[model samples]
Target: MNKTLQTDLLEIESLLELVKKQGIEYLNKIDERKTSANVHKAELINLDSKGLGARNTLQLFNETFEPTIVSSSGPRFWGYVIGGSTPASIMGDWLATIYDQNPQAINGEGDISANIELETIQLILDLFNLPKSFVGGFVTGATMSNFTCLAVARQWFGKNYGKDFAKEGITEKINVLTATPHSSALKSLALLGIGSNNIIKVNTIEGNREAISIDDLESKIKTLNGQPFILISSAGTVNTVDFDNFNAIKKLKKKYNFWWHTDAAFGGFAACSDTYNHFVKDWGHSDSITIDCHKWLNVPYESAVFLIKEEHSSLQVESFQNSNAPYLGNPMENFNYLNFLPENSRRLKALPAWFSLRAYGKEGYKNIVENAIDLAKYFGSKIKESENFKLLAPVRLNNIVFNISNNRNKENIDSFLTQLNKTGKVFMTPTLYNDQKGIRVSFVNWRTTKNDIELVFKEMNRIINIIE
Candidate 1:
């Protein structure tokens, strides 16, 4: 090996050891008052100041950096549908970094690593019961996944007449129909050529189930005439964790001629469980669906998969895609990475998922998902039993949205949320449902157990009693 390369590798090893020690040390003492929350609400320091070796800088990072992040990987972290990755996934991530494979096309990582991603895509398709011929791409997160799916949907619908709407841009108006609790990623669709103002909000909360009915959806679709309409349904909504009436939406798509897409970012994995499969019964009929492996599958961060109905539908019609002549491709055209993804240079992001799924088969995944649902229901039962806590929305899936109410001190809601955060027993979030402030807990972590749920209930009762 080259002397300089050897030296660099040695330094990396040393740093890894040091960081591991510091990380464990920091995690052990995270409850200290000095340890602050670090979810975009934390301090922003310059890159140089944040780096190691500087006496005070190293001290601050070692003392604070990770400990303060309120990581979802933590045993009690119940915030924002985050998943705790398995050791196998972590090992695969390390290998991905060491190899530094850029799977843009077959030329980047050859057929080996790129084919692994294709396999991951196929696995996701089968897991979700999507069409066998559906195309897929690895993206940064559900935002990019939704963006990619909608981008393809726009091109597919608008370019049906060879109009090239992406390049020419949407000269005519278009509307994306969706219900409340739509994944925030819808904003990405608007940002990407599809006008944000054109979003048609459908009333999903007609009853206890929290799913939008076909009657409401069909009425909305009738309002839009000649304009291109794309119906976006949620497989797992953020607030309620309720799936849209996928079967009803599927039937509507046939009659309306709108491109049907499902944003199953968090709950898509519910399909892995036999019990929750009914939530996404007709999901296979969707033109496209977004699944985030990092969320439900307990993989590491920054790994989400977007699957489309047809392979050719995902290809960008822009210059970059057109520039690369398909015929003169590398030997790995059997499953070239770039043919599917919007990204030219891609990481081996699928390995974590590949490792996790293989380590634990479909049955293993099913158990964890079902356990999460059971935990949610357990907590919901606690809320229903409590005279103080009002179940905000009906317990649908793994997400339980409810508010703690007393004699009628409404302002205490924020105080209650802060108390929960301060105690660090379980991390939850605040949301407005039916114009009322509420606490929402997402049982997305595989580490979560009956004990964890009991602890959360205990802590919540303690806080509610304190306020009372």
Candidate 2:
């Protein structure tokens, strides 16, 4: 080994201690950290023949790059429905890195990481009040989760016509119906060769709602003329947190033949509360569902799962199986995650979620979900009462979508959000809703409280005065 490598091995315990101390300090002071970073270009350093040891490299990194790190994982980061890591989740994440296990096969080659992954999936299903009839696996994020489910849906759509789209290429255009799909789902369609432009956009509810119109969806299906199609529905829309009527969609399943897929993502957490459970009622009837652990589950990034009905297990394997890789064993006989999901060699991403669920059981999650919803309502009410802001939509679930009441110019709302973010106290995302420029404040972080909302609201008023 190189001298530097030998030194690092000898000092591994001390190096880890230093890292743990830094991590603890960062976590302890996260709330005080800037919500947004003042990013600037850093000078590039050329590599030398002689290497710097890990400790020196750590110091160099702290001096050069650590200053601009933002607190997106901290409370008051009400943007894009992001969630912070729980203490238990952080522990599991550290172990996952240290173990360096690739969760692939459950009963093959003495690898049990995939079994742990399966157990984690079961825990998630129980958390969501879902049935065991659905088989699930962890993926990178909501984007990849959406991709995996939709890939299976695509295979099912093809199988309906007695065609195998996976073995052979997509031989024909597939009919996909949806309303207000998350952009990630559309990107998945593009990746799967389903052609995002080819989707039939169903109209949302008639007034002030993003939920799909059941009548319009039925009309679109009629155009298919009894052909098999895929209906990509939403459990909770990102902007307004609007939920499609899963009950109505479930009713339609009796009369129509289509693959039902709901991208629940964060909104699925509503099931944790009695008050908000109605938003996702009947969602379990869907053929597939995507939920993000990194969102309301409060796990770290790069963790999400896709739950597809067990009846479609064959199709899922067919959609993602690697047929020619002999070493992976029989795709059907051995039952590996690599055969069921998009990734072939993924880390034990399920560990954090497993740790989270085990640490805080059903009741604990109920508190987290309820608290988030209540804070969102509190913030939304503040926005409604303020003369400076107009609620663009109802304070549905854990998001508040609104517009600046007085500022008519489109650029002004964007400027207001930018300034508010510059304050480093809070961060929000801007959007265009129904042709009107709007801002969205999502409250999914478990640490966020009423006080945080009040702080952000006061900051917003200050910025409003400056912009006006």
Candidate 3:
């Protein structure tokens, strides 16, 4: 080993202790941390021939880069459906790095990380009140989760016409139908060789809603002329958090030959609340589903799950199987994640979720979900009452889509959002809804509270007055 590496290894205990102390301090002061950093320029550093060692490197990082780190995980950050990590989740994430176990095989030569992953999947299924007939695995995020599910959906579509797209390549035009899909799902289509433009847009429900219209959806299916297609449905839309009528979709599955997939990333948390469970009623009937642990489970980044029905396991293997490598063994004989999902090598991505689930249980998550929904409603009420702002859609769950009250303020939406984010007390993202400029504020962080709502309301008003 190099001299510097050996010296660093000798001081690993003290180095880790220093990091732990810093982590605790940062997390404790997160509420006061700025949610945005205006400074975009940084001094680029070159690698040194002689190492600085861990201690001096830490000092250098603190001096040069740490100040630029914005508190996206903080309570006031209501941008892009982000969520903060729970205490238990952070603990598990730290351990995952320390262990550095690659979770790929169920009965491998040595590691059993895959077993832990399987257990975590079961825990998630139970939390959502889903049936055991679905087999799930962890992926990087909702994008990859959607890709995994749709890959199998693609294979299944090919099977309906006596073809194996995975083996022979896509020789036919794949039919896809959707209404109000998250951008990530469409990106997945692009990655899966299913052209994003190929999606047949199903009309949404009449009035100010993003949910799919059952009557329109049925009419669209009739146009397919008994062709097998893939229906990508949203359990929670990004703009207004609108959920499709899953009960009605379940009824259509009986008559139509199509693979149903729901992108329930953050919205799936509705299952935790009796008051909100209706949003995803009968969603378990979906052939596949995507849920992000980082968004609503309050786990760290790069965490999501893709669940495909057990009956389609063969199709999944056919889509993702590493058949060329004989060393990986038969894809079907010995159960392995390498043949089940996109990635062949993966970390113990399920550990943090496992820790969070075991630490909080169902009641704790229920409280977290309900608290976020309450905060969103509170914030939405404030927006509705404000003279300068108006809601673009009703507060359906945990997202508030709003805009400036009148046409005069329309042109200022982008500038208003920029100024507000520059305030550093809060952060929000600009969006377009129904061809009108708007801003989206999503509440999924467990630390968010009524006090945070009050703080944000005051900040929003202050920013609006200054902008006007």
Q: Give the number of the best model, judged by lDDT.
A: 3
Error (Å) of candidate 3 at residue 424 is: 0.6
lDDT of each: 0.73, 0.89, 0.91
In model 1, the clashing pairs are: none
Ten residues in sequence with the least summed lDDT for candidate 2: 325-334
Ten contiguous residues with the weakest lDDT in model 1: 314-323
The whole-model C-alpha lDDT of candidate 3 against the native structure comes to 0.91
Name the runs in model 2 displaced over 4 angstroms.
42-44, 326-333, 407-411
Query: Which stretches in model 1 have alpha-carbon errors above 4 Å?
Result: 1-8, 11-15, 19-60, 107-112, 181-183, 311-335, 406-408
Clashing pairs in 2: none
lDDT of 2 by residue, 159-206 (tens): 887999988979988999999999999999999999878799999998
For each candidate in turn, the TM-score is 0.87, 0.97, 0.97
User: How many clashes (backbone atoms < 3 Å, residues ≥3 apart in a chain or on different chains) does model 1 have?
Assistant: 0
Give the residue spans of candidate 3 off by over 4 A.
42-45, 326-333
* lDDT pick, better of 1 and 3: 3
Least accurate stretch of 10 residues (summed lDDT) in model 3?
A: 325-334
Cα error, residue 213 of model 2, in Å, equals: 0.6
